[model samples]
Target: MSDNDSQKRAQFLAAYDEQLRTDAETPSAIKVIVQGPLRLVTFLNGRGFITYKNLGGADQAAIQRLVPEAMAYYQADAEIIRVEWKTRGHDHAPGMHEALIDNGFIRDEQESIMIGEASALAVDVPLPEGVTLRQVTEETDVRAMSAMQDEVFGDPVSDDMAEALLRRLAIDPGMELWVAEVEGRMVTAGRLELVPGTKFAGIWGGATREEWRGRGIYRALTAARARSALNHGKLLIHSDSTEFSRPILERSGLLKVSTTTPYYWKR
Candidate 1:
C-alpha cells in the first residue's frame, strides 16, 4: 500500500477505536460494569460482552489477572448464560488470547474491520429483476428478517433473536432495518445503526440466501442502507465483515482497517 493509503487506514482505525469503544457500542446493554479498562456489559438476552478502547497499557500479567476477574463477575449472574470477549487484532495487549482461552473462552472466526465514507457505498447498484429493497418496521417483518438471517448464518431459527430486535427497536427507533425481497419473499437483509455523538454508522447482520449470492442483491441492499446512513448525516460507515462480505465492501470503497475476533464462553 502507498504511504498515503497507510496513513488513511491508520486514521480510520484510530477514529474507530476512539469513537466506538464506549457506550456507543453497547447502547442496548441492560448493565455495564467498569473493571479497570474493561467494560463488562450485560444484555437482556442473557449474554455478557467485554470490550475496551485500549488495555490502559496493561502488561501480560495484568491482562491475565483481569480476564478471570471479569469472568467471575458475569458468572455470579445466573441470567447471563453466555459471554463474549471481543478482541481487536490491532490492540497491543500481549497475552489476551492465552488469558481468554485459560478462562474457558473459545475463539470464534475473525472478521475484518471495514471502514470508509458512507457516500462511497451510497452509489447506485442495480438489483436483479423482481427484487426490491425497503426498510422494515413492523414486528412481523422484523421476525421474518431475523429468521432469514439466522438460517443463512447456520443458527437455529428461533424467536429469541426476533424478540431482542424488537426490544432494540423499541429503545432506538432510529436504528434502520433494510431487506431485499423477491415477490414478497425475503432474500437478503441487514441493519443500519446511526451512532449517537459520532459521524459513524454501522452496517451489521448482513445475510443473503445462498441462492441469492452473486446476484448483486446484497450489494444493492447495502447501497440502500448506505444512502439511508448518508441521509441521517452519518459520514463514516463501519462493519465487522465476514470473509464473504469483506471483498464486496472493499470493492465498494471501504478499507480493511483491522480485524476482530470474539471469544465465547457458555454456562
Candidate 2:
C-alpha cells in the first residue's frame, strides 16, 4: 500500500474503534453493565455484547483476568442465550484470542470492515427488467423482507427478529429497511442504519436470493442505501462485509480498513 493509503486506513481504523465500535453498539442495548474496562451490553432479544475502547494496554495476565470477569457478568444474566465478544484485527489486545477460547468462546468467520464516502456510492445502478427497490414501512412488508433475508441466509424465518426490527423502526426514524421485489415477491433485503451523532451510516444484513445473485441487484440495493445515507447527511458508509459483498463494496470505493471477528459463548 502507498503511504497515503496506509495513513487513510489508520485514520479510518482509529475513528471506527473510537466511535462506532464503542458508542454505536451500545445505544440500543437494554442495559449496559461496565466491568473494569469492558462494556457488557444486554439486548432485548437474548443477545449479549462485550466491547471496550482498548484493553487498557493490558498484558497477557491482565487479559486472562479480564476475559472471565467480563464473561461472568454476562453469565449472571439468565435472559442471554449467547454473548459475542467482538475482536478487531488492528487492535493491540494481548491474549484476547486465547483468553476467549479458554472461556469457551467459539471463533466465527472474520469479516472485512469496509469504509468509504457515501456520496461515492450514491450513483444510480441499473436494475434488472422486473426488479424494483423501495424503502419498506408497513409491518407486513417488513416481516416479508425479514423472512426473505432469513431464507437467503439459510436460517429459519424468525418471528423474534422481525418483531425486534419493527420495534426498532418504531423508535429510530433514521433506520431504513429496504428490499427489492419481483412481481410483488421479495428477492433481496438490507438495512441502512444512520448513527445519530456520527458521520457514518452502516449498511447491514444485506442478502439476496440465490436466483438473484450476479445480476448486480445487490449492487443496486447498496446504491439505494447509499443514496439514503447521503440524503440523511451521512458522509461515510460502513459495513462488516462477508466475502460475497466485500468485492462489491470495494468496487464502489470502500476500503478494507480492518477485519472484525466475533467470538461467541453460549450460555
Decoy 2 TM-score against native? 0.97
Cα displacement (Å) at residue 61, model 2: 0.7
- What is the lDDT for 1 in model 2? 72
Off by over 4 Å in 2: none
State the displacement of the C-alpha of residue 191, model 1, in Å, after optimal TM-score superposition: 0.4
60-141, model 1: which lDDT tens digit per residue? 9999899999999999988999999999999999999999999999999999999999999999998888999999989999
Clash count list over all predictions: 0, 0
Candidate 2 CA-lDDT value: 0.89
Best by lDDT: 1
Every candidate's CA RMSD: 0.8, 1.2
